[model samples]
Target: MLPAQICARNERAKAHSSRYNSKRMKVGTGRLRPHRSISAGHNRDDKRMKIGNKSGAVAFAVMFAILREFVMKFVSILLALPLTMAISACATTSTDASAPAAASMAGAKLMAGDGSARGTASVTEAADGLHVLVKAQGLTPGIHAVHVHMTGTCTTPDFASAGGHWNPTGRKHGMNNPAGMHMGDMPNMTVGPDGSGAIEYVIAGGTISGEATPLLDADGAAVVIHAQADDNMSDPAGNAGGRIACGVLAAG
Candidate 1:
């Protein structure tokens, strides 16, 4: 062969050999593991980060929901505790039939014209009218007239400031008169020799308040015991002499 032809053939063989080696290397590396680009590696990292973030969010949401549920239950328990205690206390408390019912009521402390203690009185509201109770002390042993008076004032001495009888109906005083009785008219109270007495009465169709003519109006009302007995047929006040004891009504 010529020298130039031999050299060209040898170069061609070297080039083919180089290409074959490169292809073999590629196939060998592919069998071992797939080759990755820089961008593909970055995409895998991004996907891992996204999964981590989603897992964290789900865990946080579950924790928060659990915390909220616990808080709600705790609050409900706290709110019910007082009511439970109150109900238990009420259940354990003793009740008496002689005790006054839980109703609208009022009370008053009586004082004589000389400012001495004269006992106490209470008025309880009922479906009918007012249930009046009076306990008296420091009085003479005799019969006396007890009546509801106009004003609450008890200006000492004769106690005339406790105006006239609480005659809201404007009828004649005594219970037996032809003109009939006043709303203030009540039965006579008997004072014992020990100077103490108690009387209970009910004023029909009367009210403590919230009416045009309630007993406890702006001017208020009072209980008065007179020196003399009511004859049951007298006008204005049944000739009940002077007011010996007076008490101002107060609401309870």
Candidate 2:
């Protein structure tokens, strides 16, 4: 119904319009737009999840480090407590042992009646036990009673002023008797005509240190020689009268 050239032109125009509309329809509803938006959202979510996972990992690492530190500190404290207690116990034990030995080494000395008949006494350690060595010059020549007395005073006309025999246990006299006599009572001391005597005897009761028993108090005590022989049966003190020589017993 139209010229050949015009018909060709119209047909070409329709073809072009159809192609463009088809392309537009396909872009709007075919899957490309929604697919692209969904893909981008998925990528964003994945990134957010990765960030969250990394944050969680960091937190877990920090907590683990703190836990490790706490555990180490607790273990160290536990270990130190016993070691400290052991050291303290050792120190206390050592002090206890040394205390008695030190007390025995304290100052000790001896004297004679009115300090006239002077004698020197020494303390020495023996395998058996402590030994008291007493040597005296100038004394009566006969069997005499030798006893440890109370008090350290040496100045007096009659040394009897030094007080009675050293009776600490408050027991009756006579070492041979069931009742214990004074601590100072000793066997008879026999002196030669030369008026000299040497006596060696062990301390029967206990050691010089107060750890075992107190031989001499802080004020000190005395050892004396009696004028008469001890019958060895008398109570309190032997009939022995008059203190001839005296010595002060100290801690040592």
Name the regions of candidate 2 deviating beyond 4 angstroms.
1-101, 105-114, 124-130
What's the TM-score of every candidate structure? 0.59, 0.54
lDDT of each: 0.87, 0.70
User: In candidate 2, what are the lDDT values of residues 1-252, reduced to their tens digit?
Assistant: 569989999999999999999999988786667888989999999999999999999999999999999999999999999999999999999998887444453223444545564566655444454566667668779887877666766555567656777676776666676776766667777888998777877756645545444556655566777788886667868688777777666554
Per-residue lDDT for 197 in model 1?
90
Colliding pairs, model 2: 111-246, 111-247, 113-245
Tens digit of lDDT per residue, candidate 1, span 49-113?
Answer: 99999999999999999999999999999999999999877765634444544436878888888
Q: Where is the poorest 10-residue window by lDDT in model 1?
A: 94-103
Model 2 root mean square deviation, Cα atoms? 8.9
Cα deviation of 5 in candidate 2 (Å)? 89
